[model samples]
Target: MTVRDDPRIAMLSVHTSPLDQPGTGDAGGMNVYVTELSQALARRGAQVEIFTRATSSAQPTKVEVAERVLVRHVAAGPFEGLDKNDLPGQLCAFTAGVLRAEARRAVGWYDVVHTHYWLSGQVGWLAADRWDVPLVHTMHTLARVKNAALAPGDAPEPLGRIIGEEQVVEEADALVANTDAEASDLVADYHADPARVHVVAPGVDLEVFSPGTLGRPALRAALGLPADDRIVLFAGRVQPLKAPDLLVRAMGVLAERGEAVPTLVVLGGASGRPTAVRELEALAYQVGVADRLVVRPPVGREVLAQYFRAADVVAVPSHNESFGLVAAEAQATGTPVVAAAVGGLRTIVEDGVSGVLVPDHDPRTWARALADLLGDDVRRAALAAGARRASARFGWDAAAEQMLKVYELAAQVRSAR
Candidate 1:
């Protein structure tokens, strides 16, 4: 039987929108992770409820994504799009709002609570304490990860997340990590009990992202990509930290070599980062590859699949990614990837097998790798086949089954307590 047979799961994903829209600034991985995992869990006969702060006054009382998966937007304070680090004081109030939302539901609605980030961990812990439910926590990104990304002098946050994260690691029934790297980081940095942590990699929607579904020529035609030109696609928000400029610079090197083929297609919209667009445009002009660059506005899932299918390759040049949904999605579409060798991308993209991983900051090295991969159709075909094979292992069905194991463990521990 699935954990939903117990009919009690409350997911706390505050500070990020539901899977419907990728939130600004933070990684889109968390929102996708929660949504896909919850849906997967529900498919296994589990009742799952996801909670996020309502962004609009006209939103429905509850959004039913599936038969057993429901998303509830609890009423919180103003300023709809505030980042997590800026939402600490508002969490307690949000927690109260969640409790009120729950009160309106039937009794025994939630027996176990799982929270996404540290802020949501605090809120979930509060609800868990009051409702006497077991709390399971996932720290999608840690403070140390933030420290590694920031400069020596610039403080990312003054209050910090160590204390609240420590509480979740120590008190929550169990802590789940999306990768072994994250699990080890939790134990080493926060002194989280090694016995209390588990690693479950995130899953991709294989059904929707399958290869034959793309129809490359049609998709390319739809996107205005030339039939003869190779296409390099990049999706996700336009942000400095994402290192989008790195991709533009890499393409510039390819252009300088007179080997630039297949227009570089950028997906996703600017997230209040006006400078990022100017930086990319300036870099395109600097490289003299402006004519070969195409920036497609934000696209929904259907259009995104077309871009993935139409592309010769997808590039994920993140400075840090806890788990790479971009790489996974590209693989699911039977396309090869060129990614930065960091975080979860390292785990997803095998160096020469599934796709290519280049050094994090070296644009020339990235350029060489991209050129080599895109130029050799034989290698590209092999990588494409391998990527599709590797992606098959990450079906949401399997991921959801594994998550139920975590839920079962949490419930067993809670029952013992």
Candidate 2:
């Protein structure tokens, strides 16, 4: 199939802006995925414009984040205090803003529409139909998949979301999944058409995340971390879904066993709830690992790479992950990951090779894994070497090349219909 030349893309991210800082307030891997993917697409000659809901009045209506990538912030509901749950009520307004923006442009300005998350998919459904363009949707997280793996005391995803996702699956010209496992889930759980599903693994910025020349002790000192103490870094939102509590509890288990306890570094801000960070701190206190716990807000990508490099092991205990970006980034920095053997983590971490994958979320199991890895210097060094090799498979350039093909496929399907 002949690929179209530089297809213009209208990228929709209604719930969160690609400009937003990841690891805080509903911003996570999805934001990074959109930002990096757009930049990569642009580098390949694609002109991309991302539309997102305006969270602050101070933001400009449009800003060029990269050479060929633009972010347009559309006003929907009140900028402040509106969460993901509240954004669904504002979809109509958000969609209207998007349509109005396109109406100002020449006819056929956008060749295709690519949307991130379900909320944006809802907007893309109508915009693509109205504009006669193909729609490609990436359901960063699925409602049914997440609900099925909810953490203890975590609320299930709303019924409204399930219905919304179903509609998007039915309407989208193509559905992008982060892993083959996720593609299977889309077909089995969402009952999506197998022909429409495309598995495109996301990539890490190896230039930014690669192992730096600085050694661990020097990197730790530069990052103001304890040079001599072992560090187990958990980089994600402090939420039930992320399972930060399990790490704290695991620290307690390590202490109980009279084993050497590594300092637990929690790097992220409150998400889902305003008091999530405080709650995590309280949990650390309850587990008697408060002194060993360090809470830091999220940093930019370069600094985050340093944290990954300084750590002995990065722990990702999320209840579910459509894709484990944190684990991949850590591994890219030559840091071994200790992740739960679930969803995308299973694909990212190679047990006894790149990193160890705990079979379950048991605190004792995590504690043992952490202790064993931290204690075995020779094994850890071997895994670090393997990690760098393992992470080499994913690159934004390759992901963009495949995505361009998917865009072409979506266009073909739309034209056929």
Candidate 3:
């Protein structure tokens, strides 16, 4: 395989619009990653095109983000958004739209087809084979790893979504994992060729998430928190997998002992999975810490920054995250995080440095970690400062440069084939 001239890359994000609203089904991290990566790649002299389903009627057919980066909406299903589990049936139609659109292009065809999520891999695999382009897949979540880490209730039940994911891993030419854990899962569960898997971590926008700009006073007033109240926050989709109940249970433990319990703010929206709002509310009531819990819907990125800034500490107690983008965002905002030591969170937050990593599924441990951070001002300040320094390692510019290397490698492989 040899490197060649300027490459045109087609990024398949088939289920959700690359430019769609965040926190929606399959639209949070993957949407951010694809949109950010494509734009950054364009800035670095690559002709990039993002292909996604037209999930909204208001979505334009073609969106030009930069001179070299474009988002072309492929007609599939209807205007309403579909879950990734049901996306395979729509990929054939999406492929047809992509083929038609590319036929009218004046320049080079897609030298590399990069896919985000399993559904996109299904389409990319077919397109790569049909057009003789190299196929690169980014499995935002793996069914094998996710199924093993499922909450006690969600496990034991057959997950239809796992079937589609398995098909993608079995077919794709290359797998781009966000962490070593995901890379291990792909090889262990699906027997993917080890040579074809690449570990490329996700990146955060350092410019937007820089320090000292968050308006904490205004944000605290909006959330109705007292100036003196210690606030520990969790921000992400309000789904069962996110384990908001665990945070409520941990808060309950602090309340039971008559210790100083920090105000627990759960900021997120009802994205894909069944909303766990009632379960979280029930846990709060059962734990007798209803007054300490705050459940609010998603806020804008600026307000989100304020929440991150105002927090005494942030918590991400997910059962498992493929890549903990929230942890990175929190760290970027100079907020200390108390996350479960699992998945990509291991890489994002250094234990006892940027934040504390509690054992997964252990409410007592979570409570202790939360209590430790809330109790010690000096320690919290140190962690916060460390987070600011550590977050610089995940700059989007460096991430985009790494992706260019991957694209070039994929293009060289495609040319050889």
Compose the digit string of candidate 3's lDDT tens values, residues 1-417: 432445688888888776765663555777778888887777777788899888778878989987888999888887674665566677789889888887887644667888987778877877877777677889888777877788656643246556766777666656788888888888888888787688888888887776765367766787677678899888887776887788888888888889888888888766545556766777899999988888887776676777888888989998888889889989999999999888888888899999998876778888888998889989988999999988988866777787767766665555655
Model 1 poorest 10 in a row by lDDT: 151-160
Kindly list the per-residue Cα lDDT of model 1 for residues 10-79, writing each as its tens digit. 8998887665556245547687888888888877777888988776788886899888898988777774
- Residue-level lDDT of model 2, residues 49-144, one tens digit each, is 999999899999999999999999999999998889988999999999999999999998899999999999999999999999999999989999
Q: Quote each prediction's TM-score.
A: 0.92, 0.99, 0.92
Between which residue pairs do clashes occur in model 1? 4-46, 230-262
State in Å the error of residue 314, model 2.
0.4
RMSD (Cα, Å) for all candidates, in order, is 2.5, 1.1, 2.4
TM-score of 3: 0.92
Cα-based lDDT at residue 314, candidate 3: 87
Q: Which of candidates 1 and 2 is the stronger one according to lDDT?
A: 2
> What's the CA error at residue 107 for candidate 2, in Å?
0.8
Candidate 3: residue pairs that collide: none
lDDT minimum window of 10 residues, candidate 3: 152-161
For candidate 1, report its TM-score. Answer: 0.92
